[model samples]
Target chain A: MKSIFGKSKELEKNIEEYLDIVEEALLIFERDINRYLEGQYDLFEENLDDILTVENNADDILKEIKYKLYTYMLIPEARGDVLNIIESLDNEVDLCKKVLMQFSIEKPEIKDFIVSDFKELTKQSLKSAEQLVRGIRTYFEEISMVNEYVNKVHFYEHEADKLEERIKRKVFSTDHINDLCKKVHIRHFSEKLAYFSDLAEEISEILSVASIKRSI
Target chain B: MTSFLFISSGLFLGWSLGANDAANLFGTAVSTKMVKFSTAAVIISIFVTIGAVFGGTGTTETLGALGSVNALAGAFVVALAAGVTVYLMTCYELPVSTTQSIVGAIIGWNLFSGRPTQLDVLYKILGTWVFSPILSALFAIVFFKIAEYIVKNCRIHLFKIDMFTRIGLILVGAFGAYSLGANNIANVMGVFTKTSILASLQIGFITLSNTQVLFLLGGLAISVGVFTYSKRVMSTVGRNIFKISPVASLVVVLSSSVVLFIFASEGLESILLNLGLPTIPLVPVSGSQAVVGAVIGIGLAKGGRNVNYKLLGKIGLGWVLTPLFALIISYIVLFFMQNVFMQQVYF
Candidate 1:
């Protein structure tokens, strides 16, 4: 398809390049979590160790976003919403790193349903990213597309809440949770991931508000 | 026969005015990137020249006749001295006035004509040294504050606001050039008229009117000043002071011109004297000072935080010493040039 970002190939290239990195990092998290479920705990630990490095890469991308956002100020009609959304995405990546670090140090068992819900959140996040990239490109054209990204994020938040309840209930009922440190670590890891979803959802809501204003 | 010299001097003054005062008109716009330098310069030069040609006789009369000097040679000397003084000031990047420089040169030439310095005129003109800036600044500050408040409090779209403000700037620039033409163009023509030089000029069966010849001469002089000599002072006015918006700069110029017009009138000195203050009417004060005063008024209106006090101090020093510097230079140059050696050759 022809690029929707008006005239410049550069902006499209930048957004696509950053999105690829985020997608790669998210896939690695999913693979590692799946390995842990299969009881390949050592492989999971190795991948979890690799997650910290993604934060550094994400941070570098954040700098590029800042430069681009500053450039936008000079170019007319460059909706500033991208600055806040990109910043939130960077924050989500940071929170992801924290959750992975907790997982590496303290192996905690999450229920199958909870794992599926978390995977669904990841899918929603990717969907949100895809919609955001397209929405930004079509910002001057068909601006209504931003609503789909906003809806997906809110849907992911509800999913995250349900998963949190299922996991917490399982941890309480299961005798493996009798270990105090493991229970605490699992609680912290689950809470951090939930927090990331909340932040991502909030970012999406803000972008929706911005898009509404832009359309008006 | 020396019509060429007077015409040349007037063109030089006009060009210098453009180089210098155009910034007063469009400095803020140029600095803020609302307009480019070349665009501003061309617009200002054209308008100012037009202003001088059509609206500049009053000022030419005031400058030309202020100090009584009878001879054509004396008139030439006065114009020559004024021209050189302004040129030197521009060279040194001082915000000196062409008006004051001409007056000072006239005073020098008057002394040579055996008319002792008119202390009454001198004092009244000097008295403006204190009053003009203070008045201009007070009014400028008041106007600037009002303009700023209107811009802030009015729920207007930014683009529309900018468009309206730009229109305001254009009006103010036109007014400024009109004021220059009314008040300073006379400086170019007054000498010619005083010496009966205009009456002597003839072409075929058509004799040029004094006013018409003056309009052309004043217009051309200011154009030359603008084109040749006004850049440094223009830059200084635009950049040295605080970064002003186009709206604020326009207000300052309008206020300055208003204050100058008040002083340029024939009864200004008489009115001041009637008010029990000793004032001088014959000698015109510096427009540069008037502009500075107006700028200060704008600055104060912006509040103390926005005014660059350091820049004011520097300009203030230049204001105090410019006439004295011109007087000394005129004295030295005239003494040597008119003395035993060169006089035999020219006489």
Candidate 2:
């Protein structure tokens, strides 16, 4: 019984650490988003570099937890899905990293509304990560909040898509440049960064599945 | 009678100069469709008044010290000559510098008397005419190149480029205003300093400095100019200077300003002398001529064939003849008013 309690305490600690990583990633991401919104392109690039660094760190943490979970063979009912959930979480950070790297390269200018939406999404991502950790630590009562958080993430993601499409149309339609080199580059970067929204949805879907399967 | 005549004529000349020169601040921007005519007019008026009120100091001292105006009639003759020169320049659509016209008139007026100006001071003022435009053009070309390079290479989104350019223009406009304030403030107040008017006036605990009184008068004169006479000159400059692009306009403005500043700087004459060139003192250089020369330089840098020489030739002729005609007109008018119209010898 003591050994079981020790294992549970270790899991709780690991989950708490993961929450910290997500929160830090979101903060860096928020700063970059704001810098871009304010038209400080060079500062935005620097902030993006910091975010990419944080995302890499978060990826390492997610991987460590996945390895630990595998070694322990914990959460029997959710065993098969643990790797998927961890990978999805890491993929979210991975998408963020990729988007930010492109941002550093292209140094694309994001509009205010889009940046605000992105910041909101980052906040929701952090909330979902925290709730996921809570749900994992036998905090069943907090599980319901996870659904709302995930829902908010998906909602912001949809809004981001609409805004992205509008920007894409204007960019494609413009005749300022003869060829579409800059347009293609900026659009591709925007599309990739936008994939984070989808990753968040997959994370929520995976969590919902884990919750349902655990009950059964 | 002498004090009143001198003051009114000087104020009238100052007002006319403002009306003609204010457009230089906003004309290119307006011509390029970057800003509307009405918007440019209002902005120029407000900013010019503000600049004069808060900023026109260095140039005032330069004008005051340019030559000796020993009598009230000397001041009156100088104002009349400048006013006629400015109006004649306007008629020809030649954007001559009000500062230069005034300086030239003062010089012309000084030449009439036996008191020969110190050649060193005369040379220093003349040296500015040669250097201000050339230096301004070089700066404009370089600055425009830098601004263009950043815009093209930074990979900033298209919308953001437009947004950034708009903001950059506002900054450029502000800088132009500050330079105008610093340099042209001298033109309006130099006479007051020479005449020792408002030397020791104190109202409500605040002593009005010569510089401060000059600024107030400059501001008022500029306001009158903006409302009454700025439109015709604004339109003429807008239409005549090449089909202006925003980049080109920015280059013209920034470069002309750089030239104005270099001419306005202290020890500029000494620096020129050190270089073994004729030192031009802190003379009031022509803003319009500097801008025109800078524009021509931009044209040359782009390649010589890029500019319209006929238009440029016409403008150059206007510059040479404006003061000559003003001097002629004022010389004739002063002669006529004194000899033919009045039996009493006023002077």
Which one is best on TM-score? 1
Q: Write the per-residue lDDT of candidate 2 for residues B1-347, one digit (tens) a residue.
A: 55655656667766875676666766656554545556665565566656565545555656656665655555666677777777777677666666656666666655554355567765666666666766777786687677656644554432233334444555566566556655676665565556655555476987767657756666677667766777666666677764555556667877877666555555565678789997445566777777777787777766665675764675557556765665565455545545675522122
Candidate 2 to native Cα RMSD, angstroms: 21.5
Candidate 2: which docking quality band?
Answer: incorrect
- In the range B253-288, model 1's lDDT, one tens digit per residue, is 778777756655545656887899865343344567
What is the per-residue lDDT of model 1 for residues A10-120, given as tens digits with 9 covering 90 to 100? 444555566566666666766775676567887777667566777777788778756754553212222256566667666656666766666666666665545665555
- The TM-score, computed over Cα atoms with residue i paired to residue i, of candidate 1 is 0.59
> Share of real interface contacts recovered by each model?
0.00, 0.00
List the candidate 2 regions with Cα displacement exceeding 4 Å.
A1-216, B1-5, B31-33, B36-57, B199-207, B265-280, B311-319, B330-347
What lDDT score goes with residue B344 in model 2? 23
Error in Å for residue B153 of model 2: 1.4
